[model samples]
Target: MSIKIRGSNAYGHSGWFTVYCRICNRKLKIGTDLVYKCPKCEKKYNAYFCEADARGLKWKCPYCNTELVPVI
Candidate 1:
């Protein structure tokens, strides 16, 4: 499964992009707009802005030691 960003001219932005979780192969609802970064590996991820404070489940990328950021 893979997430794909879609649409055009969304919320004043030039493109209407949506977040899809590749593992789940589903389009994630945009409850909020925010981006996150992993402190360990310096990788970046996107999630709903409202979920920023939620404790993240332990997950890591196979190729890197950095914690995987959750996408809402």
Candidate 2:
């Protein structure tokens, strides 16, 4: 599954996506930050994680109990 962008309607920005780490509350920017995305829960939960947090969780989604995939 693809990472769904939430609240995309901002001033002058059309297709920009702002994602955050689920565990650290850190802002994750595409092309700069390595993010783990929950394939099963992204649309519903908007679950994204930093590399360390994702590894800490054993590459699993804590909410949906599904395997987390890295966003490349």
Candidate 3:
């Protein structure tokens, strides 16, 4: 079964995406190439792309529980 993504984060083929907070409406900038930090809300999401990552890992928003899926 294919996982469904319901949040504002759109996954692309580039294998990179910026996480956004619906409450804060702010674009999260990638820092340190590891930790995903929300500048405005100061909330950290486990940034995961639904796109084709080598490991085929899955990710969801910690606060909202929105599934991240590929936009294809």
Candidate of highest TM-score: 2
Q: How far is candidate 3 from the true structure (C-alpha RMSD, Å)?
A: 14.5
Which residue pairs does candidate 3 place in steric collision? Answer: none
Local distance difference test values of all predictions, in order: 0.40, 0.83, 0.38
Q: Pick the candidate with the highest lDDT.
A: 2
All candidates' TM-scores?
0.35, 0.73, 0.22
Write model 2 residue lDDT over 1-72, tens digit each, in one string: 976545656454534656888888988876677889999888887889999999999998999888999787
The positional error of residue 67 in candidate 2, measured at the CA in angstroms, is 1.1
lDDT of 3 at 31: 40
Q: What is the lDDT of residue 18 in candidate 1?
A: 51
For residues 1-72, write the lDDT of model 1, one tens digit per residue.
Answer: 976545553344523445544333344444455433344433254322223222332354433445556443
What ordering of candidates by lDDT runs from best to worst? 2, 1, 3
TM-score, model 2 to reference: 0.73
Clashing pairs in 1: 3-20
Better of 2 and 3 by TM-score: 2
Which ranges of candidate 3 are over 4 A from the true structure? 1-15, 32-72
